[model samples]
Target: MEEPGKIKLTIPCRLDHVHLAGHAIKGVLAETIKDSELVFLIELAVCEAVSNSMQHAHGCNADCNVEVSIFLCNSELVIEVTDTGAPFNADLLKNKQCHDPEDATCEKAAEGGRGIFLICRAMDEVKYKSFADRNILTMRKTIKPTDRDGEP
Candidate 1:
């Protein structure tokens, strides 16, 4: 099937606004993914990633904004969350969250650090990059094939 589309969104950096990304992603991907569980996973992962950017990225400053972009690439769903805040060390997140609390450092604290772990767990693939201008978190998941019209 030919790659058909993408959706991009920007929201104010506030906890209250995190739900917008979840709703937007589910709306956009609904045509391609019919699994309620997978939909929940996408929404959860997107919300967590965006929440991390808003809460930790800009010090939870509500004035800032978080950007989310979802695209169909290589027969997979690719989601990217970008922010203007200081970049954290991605190498620090190479491993999943440990069961023991002591194993997590300040960077991977159990609180919101759980978001990073969930994002990595839900999506088939996850990536992050701390660029000079912005930090980007990329997550990908392959969806079940749908009709050519993009209807599941």
Candidate 2:
């Protein structure tokens, strides 16, 4: 069983393991959150975070580890994705615009670079930091009272 208000999942830095993180988030939140859409959004944000950490940070090396810690506090759900690989420039997050899949004229149109944009759109608040040798991406979402089946 998971702890009362938090759950942490550590997975190898590989693309195949990304889905595990997503499923774990959905399973934990689905128990108390009745809204499927909200749960899906959270899951998507987390999966993108994990994928970015694995591909960009760890370079898809399975020898590394990515830790995802999720906390349910009062009316908010906070998720932190931590990795010991290369640190990123958090400032880039400020410039990400939501990528419209249908915009053919967009100069930046590509298969990548949309992770940060999607994450920002899904969560209420997003933060990124690097200290010492670790990089952590923290995302927060406010859960309205009606979204939960019971008090968090």
Candidate 3:
């Protein structure tokens, strides 16, 4: 049974399956957030998290599974992505190397860390930890009164 104000989903570790989670996130956030871009960014952050779990943590292993939990409390939205494959390096959160997309000097070889960087940029808070065999990545965003009330 799901808790009130929360939605949870489990998906096989596959890049193709990531979109289902994204759609679910968008559906939930779109209800109160009138901003389509904000909704999209949240969805994108989730998709990246799921994709990283499938590709990095699970090594694209179809046998593993990823769990996503979303919670809406007061004006905050919290999301957690969990996997059992491998623990995430929490240190990366402190040293995310973000590049300016418009900078022509940025090297394409910097492909390794953009996912976590984007996730951090999109959410107000992002955290990762592992205990026993479970690794959980939690993300949070606070919706302003104007955002929820659709006030200009």
Give the residue spans of candidate 2 off by over 4 A: 1-4, 98-108, 150-152
Candidate 3 lDDT trough over 10 residues, lowest sum: 99-108
- Kindly list the per-residue Cα lDDT of model 1 for residues 11-87, writing each as its tens digit: 99989889999999988867666677888998999999999899778878988889998997546789999999978
Best candidate (score: lDDT): 2
lDDT string, candidate 3, 43-138, tens digits? 989999999999989998999999999998878999999999877778888865564355554455454668888999899999888999999999
- Candidates 2 and 3: which is better by TM-score? 3
Cα RMSD (Å) per model?
5.1, 3.0, 2.1
Error of 2 at 123 (Å): 0.5
Residue 151 of model 1, lDDT score: 52
Please estimate how well model 1 matches the true structure, expressed as its whole-model Cα lDDT: 0.82
Could you give candidate 2's per-residue lDDT for residues 1-152 as a string of tens digits? Answer: 87687888899998988999999999889877998999999999999999999999999999999999999987889999999999877877886564646656556568678889899989999999998999999999999988997754
Each model's lDDT: 0.82, 0.90, 0.88
Task: Order candidates by TM-score, high to low.
Answer: 3, 2, 1
Residue 107's lDDT within candidate 2 is 69
Considering lDDT, where higher is better, how would the candidates rank from best to worst?
2, 3, 1
